[model samples]
Target: MIYQDTFGFAQQQDEQDELKSFRDEFLFPQHNGHKVIYLCGNSLGLQPKSAGQYIKIQLDNWENFAVEGWFMGDDPWLSYHKALLPTLSGLLGANDREITVMNSLTVNLHLLMVSFYKPTNKRFKILMEAGAFPSDQYAVESQVRFHGFNPKEAIIEVTPRAGEVTLRTADIIAQIEDNADEIALVLFSGINYYTGQLFDMESIVKAGHKAGAMVGLDLAHAAGNVPLQLHNWGADFASWCSYKYMNSGPGGISGAFVHERHFANDKLNRFAGWWGYRRDKQFLMQPGFDPELGAQGWNVSTSPVVLMAMHKASLDIFEKAGGIVPLRKKGDLLTGYLEYLINNINQKQGEEVYRIITPKDQKDRGSQLSVVCKRDARAIFDYLAQNGIIGDWREPDVIRLSPVPLYNSFTDIYHAAEGLFKALGATNA
Candidate 1:
């Protein structure tokens, strides 16, 4: 697997790629009359070409069926989301009964917390990684305050060791063990949004359970970008946004996962609505809240058919490509090539001009490589943008370049390296 810093090598790799045709399925943003090298799937993915047709079908249904669209169209609005569960459940490694498509990421997280994060006088704290996405921090803080507990006293953050960019799995398990008595919930991102370090979900779950605390995950960055086994790992609950790796469009409909063990646990609390009521008895307009038997019981309002249609469009592509396994195989090669080229750039400079902070092992990271520019960081980022290299930027100095396997080719990686090289010169770094 020797990587060469040449266009010919990249082209050769692309020629051998079985999933190469998937690149043609997406619509990329144009720059200077050419398709831009989009390396920002970590933020938002490119639109699937089929997305329009998917939406049009629903729009036409609304036009033809009017209010009766709920029960009348080819894909009745009453059960539109059910068709999506098979593919979504396959991506999450969970039973169809355990997954449901619903509100945005944080909203789902808050709703799940209502069911899983049951705090008491003895165990009222929540344990999580430091530097989590601000939304998670805010959600946990507000939840803690709502229960009349001070956030400072109710939240425990696991920090990396001195001078380390990523957290070690041992440290995470130890933190869970150390705070076992006071922890009511152990929540963590499946992959850290900043470092791109994939956590050991199975070990974390076991440790949390041993400590008598519930475990949950925020898979906003990990959902479609990497393979997951939420059921096997025994995570109590989880939520993820579909926009990034799943490519369902910006602010897309999010999803949730609740283990079967909790399906019959009526002790859990939920903010119920008509959508969550038992489907068979729903039309009766009954009295008490009688939820559906599985994760669909968490649904709050009517289904957003259009958003689910957009999601179905991308998921059909995944099904055609044979699910996350093949995608992950291609993703590993694409990201490894990017890492190799970045290391080559640093070697050529004879100094560490770009320091990658993401985990080096493929098992510990997805498609993203979070690089820290040692000099002229902002200018270098702008230079890449001007050259049509679309990467994501974080404050201070980190630049995230993610080579998505579904639409990205090895040639894209080669050109991105060229952009980085030219950017160094353009910025005089």
Candidate 2:
């Protein structure tokens, strides 16, 4: 698996890519009348070409059927969400009954915490990785405060050892065991948004369960970017946003997964809403709140048909490409090639110009590589953007680039590295 720096090598790989045609499925951002090489799928994915058509179908349904669209349409709004479950079930590695489309990721996180983050006099602390997404940090802090506990006391952050950018699995497990008696919940992101490090969910879940705590995962970055096994991993609950890797529109619909084991746990608490009421008795207008059997029990309000249409447009493409397995294969090669090219740049410069902080092992990361600029960090980022290369920039020093397998080509990776090479010289001047 030797990689060459020549653009021809990238072109040859593109020629052999089974998923190359997927690049045509998306609409890219233009710079000077030419499409920019989009490598920011880790933040927001490119829109699918068919997204407009999908929305049009729903709009036409609204026009023709009006109120009757709920019951009379070809694809009834009543059951439109059901079509999404099969693909999502496969993506999240859960049964269709265990997954449901619902509120945004943070909203669902709070809802799930209501049920899973129960604190007691004996065990009341929550353990999580340090530097999770700010929304998750805020959510956990607020939830802890709402429960009448000081966040500083109730929340435990597992930070890396000195001088280490990424966490080691051993440290994570030891921290869980050390606080075993006091930890009520162990929640972590499936992949850290900054470093792009994929946590070992299976080991984490087993450790938490053995220590008498509920384990949950926020899969916002991990959902479509990496293969997950929420059910098999035995996670109590999980939530993810679809806009990033799923290419559903900006702020698109989010999804949740509740293990089947929790289905009949009547002792669990929820912020009840009518949409979560049993479908069979929903229209009966009952006074009591009886929730649906599985994850649907978490739904809070009416389904937005338009958002579902956008989500379906992208998911249908995933189905056509045979799901995340094939896409992830190409993603590895694209990212690997990018890493190789970046290393070569550092070698030629005789100094660390772009220092990659993400884990080097393919198994430890996904499509993203977070590089810290040793010099001219912000200038380097602006240079790439001005040149029409779309890698994301984090505060202070890091630039995050994600070569999405579905829409990003090997040429995109090559051109991105080429931009980095040119940027080094420009900044030096």
- Give the TM-scores of the predictions, in the order they appear: 0.99, 0.99
CA shift at 42, candidate 1, in angstroms? 0.9
Model 1, runs deviating above 4 Å:
none
Residue 412, candidate 1: Cα error in Å is 0.5
Candidate 1 whole-model C-alpha lDDT, 0 to 1: 0.95
Candidate 2 C-alpha error for residue 305, in Å: 0.9
Candidate 2 lDDT over 138-239, as tens digits, reads 999999999999999999999999999899999999999999999999999999999999999999999999999999999999999999999999999999
The ten-residue window of minimal lDDT in model 1 covers: 420-429
Error of model 2, residue 217, in angstroms: 0.3
Model 1, C-alpha of 269: deviation from truth (Å): 0.5
**For residues 1-429, what per-residue lDDT tens digits would candidate 1 score against the true structure?**
788989999999999999999999999999999999999999999999999999999999999999999999789999999899999999999999999999999999999999999999999999999999999999999999999999999999999999998889899999988888999999999999998898888899999999999999999999999999999999999999999999999999999999999999999999999999999999999899999999999999988999999999999999999999999999999999999999999999999999999999999999999999999999999999998999999999999999999999999999999999889998874
Compared with the true structure, all predictions reach lDDT values of: 0.95, 0.94
